[model samples]
Target: MTKTFKTLDDFLGTHFIYTYDNGWEYEWYAKNDHTVDYRIHGGMVAGRWVKDQEANIVMLTEGIYKVAWTEPTGTDVALDFLPNENKVNGTIFFPKWVQDHPEITVTFQNDHIDLMEASREKYATYPKLVVPEFAHITYTGDAGQNNEDVIAEAPYKGLPDDIRNGQYFDQNYHRINK
Candidate 1:
């Protein structure tokens, strides 16, 4: 038998870590730990599931998703997942005052996600900034996995100083507990 997720309920109680590959490297904690009445808009469903105080809206389409929020910070993100593959191509557009947005690609499987920036020229001026041109992160505490055990056995260590000191490479973010 094959498994299919046709509704938000399928993802409820799931937790995952989201990482960005831009020079100002950052990671987001995502948890589908809430239940809400999702508003259906045409071919998309919009609602909030992540445990954040900001007003957020998530739109889901076939193989694509868009999540936008306003509060502590404002951001507009769109992700297009590849067919049958744990890979996605996306872009992040920040409001003015943040920085120029860049195209990003991501791949995920089980409890891990890897992100890479597709455009480097966008930050030509801030050359010394260490952005995770590539970032790898893990999502623990899912599917009966122990968060502590996962963190202890995680492959990547702390961010290298070279990466912060101007050297650029794929960076790794340790698994964070929810």
Candidate 2:
């Protein structure tokens, strides 16, 4: 079959998933030509946090195109979407700041004084200047089995009320009964 992808507009309001070969999977829902919501299926933010990012897309051929976006945390990710073959070429570019500053983490306070429970935004108590150095993380991946993915309605939409309330750390899985 001939692929006729000319621009991101071709897939507006569409949901797609990338099942990366590296054992990771992510869901992407294109809200429009410039915005997309992605959900991470694993790791610290898995099923807990989701972000809508401004995306930049480009077409390389009929069925192939690249979609790139800068996450709020400064991680740059680019994915070459091959819709017809259910394939994707993905690259996650990490700035040196991620490795150079390991101490930076989520601070409930020092950032959000208005919110009653926790800061809805990144705890900006301490900000760093990232150098131009970057590491290119490349991976070849397959598409999701289907496009009927569960979309995160909002940022951190999957967060539990207990965690969002900060009654305690969600460490039930880590703490052993002693």
Candidate 3:
């Protein structure tokens, strides 16, 4: 038997750390306002609305939910959520890029998220391949800290200079207070 959540409300008030594929990181929060806020550390030090739309949560199976939304760029994204395991699986579709290499699967776990590019011979020319193969996003502290501090303490801190500065997406992000 598996547990099921009645609504997206179950995820409200939760905080998470999101790490992009390019090593950029941000703190994420699901607010009561139905908006997802992001605390960026690069150029902006403030929390802003990265997603304001209401997420469409559909129960796919027992203990499994499908959350989806459309981006401002008209791209539709969806994630399969397994609340019991605190995990999410999703594929990011890049409509404007090479059609064959449009989708990349990402796995988000309790402590980390895998952001490696999907294996495909068609993506052989992708620039990110030059960097370390396995990229992961790990949880850190709160936002508002200096970028230097974040980078210094990241798991990738010991990576080669070229790989660190390369197109790798490995990063550490902070989680906001609930």
RMSD of each: 14.6, 11.8, 13.4
TM-score of each: 0.34, 0.52, 0.38
lDDT of 1 by residue, 27-46 (tens): 23223332111111111111
Q: Model 2: clashing residue pairs?
A: none
Question: All candidates' lDDT scores?
Answer: 0.27, 0.46, 0.37
Where does the lowest 10-residue lDDT sum fall in candidate 2? 134-143
Among these predicted structures, which one has the highest TM-score?
2
For candidate 3, write residues 1-178 as lDDT tens digits. 1333445554544443444455544444444433443343321112222434356655666656565665432335565655556455554443332233322322121122122222332244333211111113243222232222222222223222322243322344331111
Error of 2 at 10 (Å): 2.7
Give me the runs in candidate 3 sitting further than 4 Å from their true place. 1-8, 18-28, 32-35, 38-49, 59-63, 97-178
Q: Which stretches of candidate 1 lie over 4 Å from their true place?
A: 1-4, 18-65, 79-84, 100-178
Among these predictions, the greatest lDDT belongs to 2
- Candidate 2 wrong stretches, greater than 4 Å: 1-7, 43-45, 96-150, 153-178
lDDT of 1 at 164: 34
RMSD of 2: 11.8
Model 2 over residues 21-130: C-alpha lDDT tens digits? 54554556555567666655433234423334578866677766777886545556777776656666777654444434322312221232344122224343234333
Model 1 scores a C-alpha lDDT of: 0.27
